[model samples]
Target: MNQLELLKKFTIIVADTSEINSICKYKPQDATTNPSLILKAVELKENRKFLNKAVEYAKKNGGSKKNQLTNASDKILVDLGIEILKYIPGYISSEVDARLSFNTEECILKAKKIIQMYEEQGISRKRVLIKLAATWECIKAAEELKKDNIFCNLTLLFSFAQARACAESNVFLISPFVGRIYDWYVSKNLISTFSYNEDPGVTSVCKIYNFYKKHNYKTIIMGASFRNIQQILLLSGCDRLTISPVLLKELELNNTVFNRKLIPPTIFLEPPRPLTEDEFRWEHNQDEMAVQKLSEGIRNFGKDQLLLEQIISKLI
Candidate 1:
């Protein structure tokens, strides 16, 4: 078997793009999307149909300009998710508006809205994972969302504190960005190249994995945003790894032998006392890399979201 098939024995592979063709070709167990991916996908000629449908949904709803645009923007996500669900049997991760990342109430509302859109289309809420940024407010928001049976995938997760907080909240999953963290270190000229064990991104996820396994935390750790095939190979036994189509193709072509590196510990320890909001903030802030990346990630996603809205507005 090729690496992709072998890796599947341990980790659940997820397609990280909004492109339907790639999802069909690679056949990942699950799929994830963000505004940047949706923006790129919507621009493609083949995906123009989804845009038209979203625009019509907004117009038929008959709201103010702002309300219509909001509805249209959300419609695009639901439309894409609904389509992806046809190809993959597992859950689809649709992220909330990045602009609402820091607003707990807004985050919760947006999450519910996404869920409602999916459910209205005859898709069960069980097939959807409402994604949110790993901000303190969003984490707190996720805690409440769980009561309504809304599972969340916390992105922009770089610090261990965020992982701890997510576990405490008992979120369904957490997507730690492996590539983004590696990119930060590279930009600083920290290291040009290194072995898998020395890679900061791999180490971060491993640390989180061990923590969860040792303490018997139920939250899933899906290693995402990989930079290379080696990063994916190193995280062979992660709960899930979201890969781009290009890398999936590479994995399919390569017959490299790799071992499962992550295994659950036999003995479980009592989880530590949950961290207070102040502690999570302080610990997360102390990691310069995490602080900068989380801010930049939110800003980048926000920009793409505005651009997506603009594209949908033109159609309306």
Candidate 2:
């Protein structure tokens, strides 16, 4: 069997894209989208119809300029998600606005609004996973959303602290970014001499996976942001993996033999004591790479979100 088929034996493969064609071609069990992916999709002529529809909806509803912009942006995102859902059989992760990453109340409100929009279109909440940054406030917001049966996928997670917090909060899923972590180390010249197995990004996910398995935490770990096929292969047995079309195509073409590198521990180990809010902040701060990458990810997503809004504003 090819790598994609072999890997599916142990992990659920998720296409991480906003392009309907790619999602349809790969036929992944689930798909994930963010502001960046949604923006990229809107630029394509084929996808512009959805954007135009959203802009028209926002204009007809008529509100203040700011409200109109926000409404259009949200509608566009949900519309893309709705389109992608038509191709996949499982969940599609829809992210909250990165600008609201730190505001617990705002995150909660926006998450509810996205779900409401999906529900309005006749989609059930079970098929949608709300994506949020791993900020404490966002985690808290996710906790509250969980009570109402809204699942969440905690993104921008780098440090173990973030993973632990999400697991403790009973989040539905956590996307520990493998490629972004690898990028940070390579940028700092910290991994000048490392093997694929020793890749820092792979190592980070391995640590989190081991912790989760050892302690029997139920938060699903879906490795994301892979820079190469090796990183994806290294995490073959993760609960789930979100792969870009580029790498997914690579896997589909190559029939190379690869074994499962991760397996659940036969015996459970004691989980570390939960970190307090202050401790969580300090621990996260000490990991300079995590600190930098988390901030950068949020900023980049926010920038793309603003750019998307500008595109919609012109249409209005």
Candidate 3:
């Protein structure tokens, strides 16, 4: 079997793209979209119609065409998300503004707004997973959103503490980034071959997976941010994995045996060690890689979000 099929044997493969055509080609069980991905898609000739329609719709609905255009962009994003969802029976993840990571209240408010937008289009909460950064404030926001039956997919996760905190709060899903971990190790000159068991990213997810399974947390684990096919293959049997289209294509073309590398329950039968917020904060504070990357991820997402808003404003 090709690597994609091999990975499928062990995990639910998600196509990480906003391009409907690319998603249709891979037939990923689930799909994820970020502002960055959506921005990229809107720039495409084939997908430009979606943006155009958004502009026209906005012009008709509001104070100015510009204001209308912004609304249209938001509507178009939701429409594009719902359109992508039509191809899969599984869930589609749509992220909120990374800029609001520190404002739990704003995050909750925005999440509700997005859900309402989707519902207005006949999309149900079951099919839409609101994505948020794994900041403490975002986690608290998710807790409130979860109470409202709004499921969440916590993204930008980088450490065991973040995973543990999410599990404790009972989130719907957690996306522990994989490729970013590899990036850290590479930059620090820590890359080394393992006997299919010691890849840093693989080990990171395994740690989180075992913790959740052993403790019986219902929050699903979805590994995201992949750099290579090996990283995806190594994480087979994870609850779900979101992979880039380029890597997904590589997986589909190569013949590589995929195996169940992570069985959380069997692997983590011991009781989960308890963690206080103080301890969690301290642990994360000491992990330079996690601290640096989490900050960097938030900054990058925030910058892109700012740029997107600017683009929307100009068009409005």
lDDT top scorer:
1
Candidate 3 lDDT over residue span 1-316, tens digit each: 7878777777898889987777889899999998788778777788767776777667778785545644765776788888898998889898887888889998998899889989998999889999999988888899899988999999989988888888877889999988898789878888765444567777899888877888678899999998877777777888999988898888889985656778765553554655676877887787787888888998988777667666666666
TM-score of 2: 0.98
Q: Residue 285 of model 3: what lDDT?
A: 82
Relative to the true structure, candidate 2 has a C-alpha RMSD (angstroms) of: 0.9
lDDT-based ranking: 1, 2, 3
RMSD of each: 0.9, 0.9, 2.5
Q: Estimate the overall C-alpha local distance difference test score of candidate 2.
A: 0.92
> lDDT per residue, candidate 1, 77-115, as tens digits?
999999999999999999999999989999999999999
> Model 3: how far is 29 from its true place, Å?
1.1
C-alpha lDDT of all candidate models, in order: 0.93, 0.92, 0.83
Candidate 1 local Cα displacement, residue 163, angstroms: 0.6
Report the lDDT tens digits of candidate 2 across residue range 202-261.
999999999999999999999999999999999999999999999999999989898898
Structural similarity to truth (TM-score) of each candidate? 0.98, 0.98, 0.91
